[model samples]
Target: MTERAYFDELYASSPDPWDLAARAYELRKYDLTVASLPRARYRRAFEPGCSVGLLTRLLVERCDEVVASDLVAAPLVLAAERAPAATFRRGGVPDDWPPGRLDLVVLSELLYYLSAADRAATIERARESLDPGGHLVAVHWRHPFVEAACDGDTAHAEIRRDPTWRVLVEHVEPDFRLEVLERGAD
Candidate 1:
């Protein structure tokens, strides 16, 4: 059910489950995610499934307000300390989706953890939340793992099907797929 228990168990064993802080791969990925954003500045952004907030830290530099959330609270505690500038909360996607319009929504390495239906719901939620002409960026690992309900290609291909999304940037690599799409208006 959206990998909540897996995350909880992972966090209980280690504060940083994937070792996101120390990985050069993650650093490069995060940099690419920031670089891919079409706008230099955003009014408000939502970063769901933000584990440890490394990306959220960088996002705060470009966004006026950032809401970073995770299903597991243990990581949010650390994420708050790591990125005090952004607001950190304990929440999940779809069901716990936040209220209010958004200028940007980041679904980073998070979609694969959910079942196909929830993944679509998460994307739809972003579509509904976006202020017209807002941006939605999704980054996911390309390879399949035991925890993933689907591969990056499957999830990203679904995003491409949305009628309102206009592709701004599509960066594909062996390791990951990153897409920055604008909602409404070509």
Candidate 2:
């Protein structure tokens, strides 16, 4: 797993290490991620690794309630200011999942940072947290990077191995991959 201190130091250097709010690529990606949601509205949503809340802000438009979390606190502060309607928390996947059933779970640009075990655990936890027929959206950068434990395809391949999820929407580009899937009815 990516250590918390790594993110702490990154946030300390710059509030927007990813430049999620200013870059056109990021803005477009966030828009596409939100736009790809199969449902017009969701009752409740959870967004892990909601850096600076750029996507969280858009997610708010589609969900009645959004609980967004990050490993570090600095970005969560900025996220709260950007998306005041959504709840913010300091946490990450595999170890930190919200209580109750969620209608939507978003794993955006986050899975690659986790160790293999943590990534698998995170996927399982996400599945368990959702109600049957609930949606889960994942979007990640396609290129290999120094900080990532694996490439985006590798991370997503783990998710695809499960037979219970049915893909509702999929979009692949040179820079990224995005998918929206629904949990199978029990």
TM-score (all chains, Cα) for each model: 0.97, 0.98
- Strongest candidate by TM-score: 2
lDDT of 2 by residue, 145-183 (tens): 999999998888889899899999889999899999899
Taking the tens digit of each residue's C-alpha lDDT, what string does model 1 give over 30-96?
9999999989999999999999989999999999999989999998988888889998878889788
State each model's C-alpha RMSD to the native: 1.3, 0.7
Candidate 1, poorest ten consecutive residues by summed lDDT: 1-10
Superposed model 1: Cα runs more than 4 Å off: none
Candidate 2: which pairs clash? none
Model 1 clash count equals 0
**CA lDDT of each candidate?**
0.91, 0.92
lDDT of 2: 0.92
Error of 1 at 163 (Å): 2.4
